[model samples]
Target: MSTESIRPLIGISCGDLNGIGLELIIKTVSNNKLLELCTPIIFASNKAINFYRKSIPDSNFNFQQIKDFTRINPKQVNVFNCWEEEVAITPGQLTPEGGKYAILSLTAAVEALKAGQIQGLVTAPIHKKNTQGDSFPFTGHTPYLKEAFAAKEVVMMMVASNMRVALLTEHVPVQEIGPHITKAAIVSKLKLIEASLKQDFGIDRPKIAVLGLNPHAGDEGLIGAEEENIIKPAIKEYKQQNNAIVQGPFSADAFFARGYHERFDAVLAMYHDQGLIPFKSLSHGEGVNFTAGLSAIRTSPDHGTAFDIAGKNKGDESSFISAIFTCIDIIRQRTAYRENRANPMKKLTNRLLANAVDEKIEE
Candidate 1:
């Protein structure tokens, strides 16, 4: 390997052993064509990966286990066995074994990414309920990755091909969205979205379309003040700080209409349902969930562990492929940003750092 040409070591975290994580892992790693792009390492138990292959019966993947991340070669499916659970790993069974194994695999993946052993991360879905049974504080994959990296700031961005969408507030109820929708939150999310585009998506100038909280942009505060009071103010502040093409508090319905997608880079949704409903409707089973504002790159399938269909061989791998592709895109941009002298974050902002600290202290 040449020092000048650094190949990205991609680490994949196997989620629920009972779910499609294993299936997708088999399909993706075996596809001879894709494996040649970079080195692929699975932070999972070899036994579990082999057990799940019976469902796909004729799968052509070779699950080769490796001891260290650095020792991985570009031509093989290098796996790091982190699963210490002794319980028998079975197909379509939600055992404590599955829960324990998922946690182990995830921890190994996080360490690899933090240590820079891998340039990108692609995590499969893990059953939150199954994990919690083993005393794990698992809400879902996005939040887990957010806390794993422990970034002072973060937002969940969903991507499907050319369409990109981000939620300002995720995993919160509709009623709670009113109180949590603060000026700083909106401003922070917009800044992160813009920076992610320029840093991870390789956009010199990103055009962001902000979605309104209320119908028809609150009818000018007649129905709701969140749009006029919160959304507009946040957008204006973001524009003052960033030179990117940041515009709109577009109504939810209108944003997806009128072919505005061709003009914008991404959409900053006001809340979980408002943003995800449209995104999932069109891109579900095919989208990738990327957690931004972390020190390292993080991405996963936009769906969760379909427990009912575990090991059924009916699980779609489109979203998982999206995750792999998203990581590739992010790594490419990061690599280019590092090699090229023209980078936006050449200097650090102590004031912003202090503000982030103060915000944490205040919270």
Candidate 2:
């Protein structure tokens, strides 16, 4: 299909209503100009939108209610009503109902993704603790999606215009972070990061910088042995295999300070805070959280649901807006990648056809 004709359907999950989820969603789609890029189907309800509308009364964002994918309006913001029962809408207050509805919207959007009803997914933030229940036992979206799609691996990578960072361990306590920093784990993530860069981001070859698990990168075993015994070896092995350019075991502090981050396509940190702390600082509220290595594309705003300013209409929507654009851009890139892979000889075929036509004209 023509690029213009194939405007990807992006499924947006309403995160914790108590936080800034709904507010950001409304702010993102408030401008009608965004519809020209792709069709957005929000997995939320009219009531939730109305609640946020009251908070931000000046927003021009509007939603077209749809029962299913068939009812989507390409030119308008579409809301798939996940539930009809009136749930209490208390902005800025965390409640069981908030988590419950967040799951509802997320689950609905995931189903749509699996069924091929949507081309990609851009989820809003969901409070990790309250969103966890019998159905969603995992800590966050990465693990849940890994199980949902039966994906072998999914790397939680944060993307800003200037920097890209991936975490080796996600949502784990600081004390428990060391155990997960083994050679095998680091190697696994390195390979995943390399492949994701090539396939998702269109980088032919990716150079990754790896951070150490201890202070001063173990200070050559003075602080910890992880750098010498685990992280360094993994980087060496992966590099020897000729997969991609992998280097590091750098001290996390100095790496970002000296602008070493710009040397590589991506940086692999040992834990969440190790990576996210610098990423958020550099991103300036415009970072996008991309779950790489999934069969489908999924991106979310890097920031979490800000409960303190939920109902105040004070939430910044730049990250959310960037997330939406990122999804669309990735979908387009994937389409082009597939087309190129599917027909490797297209260029040669065109050349041969042109030569034959010239010969026929001469004859």
Best by TM-score: 2
Show model 1 residue runs off by greater than 4 Å. Answer: 1-6, 90-95, 132-135, 342-363
Tell me each candidate's TM-score.
0.87, 0.93
- lDDT score of residue 86 within candidate 2: 88
| Model 1 C-alpha lDDT versus the unseen true structure | 0.76
lDDT of 1 by residue, 1-363 (tens): 231143467889998877678788777777665564556789987777777777787678886788776577777788888854554756677777777778878888999898888888898878766786445675776666677787778878988866889998887878888888788998888888888887777677889999888889898889899888888888888888775577878878977776576578899888888878788877746888898888788788887777777777877777876687678667766656655546546424322432333343233
Each prediction's Cα lDDT score? Answer: 0.76, 0.87
Checking candidate 1 for backbone clashes, the offending pairs are none
lDDT of 2 by residue, 202-293 (tens): 67788899998888999999998989999889999989986579888999999999989999999999999999999999888899999988
Any idea how many clashes model 1 has? 0
